[model samples]
Target: MTALMKQNIRRITTVLVSSAMSAFATVQTVGNFSVLSMNTAGLPDFLQGNDVPGDKTENHRMIGAKFVEYGYDIINVQELEFKLNLGQDFNYHAALYSTASLPYRTPTSGGVPFGSGLNTLSRYSFTDTTRVKWNDCSNFGGADCLTPKGFTLVRVLLSSSPEGYAYVDVYNIHADAGVTNADLVARASNLRQLSEYIDNWSAGNAVIIAGDTNSRYTRVRDEIRILTRENGMTDPWVELIRDGVDPTEETICANPTTLSYCETVDKMFYRSSPVLNLQAIGWSYESSRFLQPNGDILSDHNPIVATFSWSLPASLRQSELYGGPHDTWFSDTGVLSRIFSPRISTIRFRGGSRLDAVSVAHVDGTSITHGGTGGRASELKLTDGETWTEAKLCLGQRNNRTGVFAIKARTSAGRTLTAGSSTEDCAEFVAPGGWGIVGFVGGSGSEIDKLGFLFAPH
Candidate 1:
């Protein structure tokens, strides 16, 4: 071929590559990360390796190597404790930490017979790290009370997202073992304690909880629903692997390694934040990856890995949706429904004993109303330079039905509007620093059943 023809072909290839790159860039808002949760079976060397194969310290070294090899972004490990006078250069903690590629790690909570045997290793920096001991434990089940088995929390800073800095609260828990009645009660209490702590501390934040739960979804009286139902967490295994169905007692597998439906005690749960949306993209038991050179397993329990895809909305950040179930859902961020103006000019509440409806008017002369039109209407208007800053909503029972009983809206300029009856069962939604409320999202029919806030950077 002629030199001119060859040059033309090269130009065509360049254009095609550029077009593909541009298409990829348009969808760069979504980011992905992976987490691995394992019960390392790191009992003391004298405990005969807790019935798991291989030397305790050596197995830890291999586990760390495998973690790095698999490129897990975060690792939550249970039963990884250090022991004194083991006559080795390093204990289990040092063996794993020194070998893993993850730069940030929490020190072992304590050693065997005393510590919580929980640790977290991550590639991202973390803060507000805390460990809480279980308030209830039963000696009838597996000596759970002997060690301070509970949960650990770390606020991980994910700086690598497309939109810059994001924070996620990560938790690692190890509940009471055994199936005795006392064991079940103590495990239930453990889950309740964690749920309360999450509601208090991690509210409105992205969260991921994983580790050896010592409880099963199929097991009666497990109380695992507290985390999912009460806290709005999603189990990745159930969602991705089990097709959104929990296994029954008859379907429980004795050897999860050989089965596709593996529901083990080692589990992972996650929820999204207002600013960040997280979805489980993949789930795996990871049994083959943790095998020893001799083809034996690394631990008595297989490690579970979950891959998550996260994205940030173009401009709006949402607060947690609150209140009761409704027939329909609405969000101000919808393409055809979003408020065109950056500032909310007016908020009108219609209610008396219970909230009936809400209407928001924007500076651009566009307005949207939701809920039933049965109650008295009250409006709060914002002057120039004024911004909506917060909302307080109370949920209560009215006419034998549960719904929003009170609604209050406050502006940065000290203006306030309140409607309906006041109650103690309330939640406050406030904009984060450098952010302001832009709009609202909720469900409404004859009455406003649920409510949430929308935020944008000021």
Candidate 2:
């Protein structure tokens, strides 16, 4: 009787797991409405004195138009002080702050306020906005005393409609640049405060807190760990990448194409609320493409974009278990399993296109679907009449490479499995500069397995 009871439990668990897999096959298909988040490449140069051809207002208009073209609903702007005519041209509602004039300090090189750092602009009507003041406990009586800058928080309500009010809170931080250790600690503290504030204000509402949180060193990474583990906010960009959506872009760099050492400093964080369903998050060089034949690095930082669907389950905010220090793949497999991780894992797709008609096959069966190309935005799913098995996956792309597709599965024994690009390549969607697929196989295998392929361009 005990053995029979155990068998029944095992069967139930298997059915539940299979149902979840089927649901995975249907990801990103929900109610249509969505909201997106992005960092405003950087403030326009009239603010920075880069000596381009236009006045501050004109320059802002040009850049503002470019930002709008990217379809960003909310934008966080760093170095707001550098832009001479900062807010004159942009039509969106905005808030700006800086620490430049904080007591006991010489003006910043760019002449923006110190401590008074990050700012934000938005297309949707913001119900209210406020800045969290910095602590001035440090008093270096010297002629050039270094005063600490306070982190700034901007609260924007998405709507005033009686629909119970859902809002995304934006917390922007520009920590100390050169000093590695101290900078991370300070930034972490600021992030904790921001997270606490959001948690306090909206409790269970959808919350998105983003900015340039510089977490590189071991110390900073530790703080980030605290943020994720304790605060329950997920880094959608990182999570999506783990799910096979390479949304990273070369944002902070000494020069274009030649990336600097400190990449991924800028990031977006999402609260795990059922209301805040992160659909796709990515970065864009769309504005950079418009740069005149002349050379200018748009803004020093890259713009990170996150798309959210209102109906996605809260589970979407839970980071998936893959490709990390303590990931599920770690204990289960070794060696070759390591190669299964993406070699050149993160690359921001510049062109915004769509990948159409892609397919995926599990050990049990197969299915198909589609998504945008370029950034970590590609889509594929089960076709029909086929349940997924252990190792088989087939995907085809139609729109050049507008999207990205990744693979995840479980063996019959219930061991979780993860891997890199699928064998199926998009021979069909191959266009001049379009969308397509990068496939992966599920089970323990050696050698490329071609499920199928598709191609398209926009």
- Residue pairs clashing in model 1 are none
lDDT of 2: 0.38
Q: Which is the leading candidate under lDDT?
A: 1
Estimate TM-scores for all models.
0.66, 0.44
Q: Tell me the tens digit of each residue's lDDT in model 1 across 180-282.
A: 9999999999999999988766755679999999889888687988999889999998998888987785354442286758568888999986557899999
Error of 1 at 48 (Å): 5.9
Q: State the local distance difference test value for candidate 1.
A: 0.80
For model 2, how does the per-residue alpha-carbon lDDT over 1-458 read when each residue is reduced to its tens digit? 69999999999999999778656534532432223323333344333343434343434444555555555566665444332335544221122222111111112223233334345556555532455544321222111113233444444544422111233545655543333444444556655665566555434445566666655423433266555666676766566644533333333433333331334556666663432444444433233433433666444455555666544331111111111111011011111122222111111111122111222322222222222223233322333322222222323343332122334432223333333344343222111112112222111111121222211111
Model 1 residue runs over 4 Å out of place are 1-28, 86-90, 160-164, 250-256, 318-458
Candidate 2 Cα outliers beyond 4 Å, as residue runs: 1-59, 82-117, 136-165, 217-222, 242-262, 274-276, 281-295, 312-458
lDDT score, candidate 1, position 6? 100
* TM-score between model 1 and native: 0.66
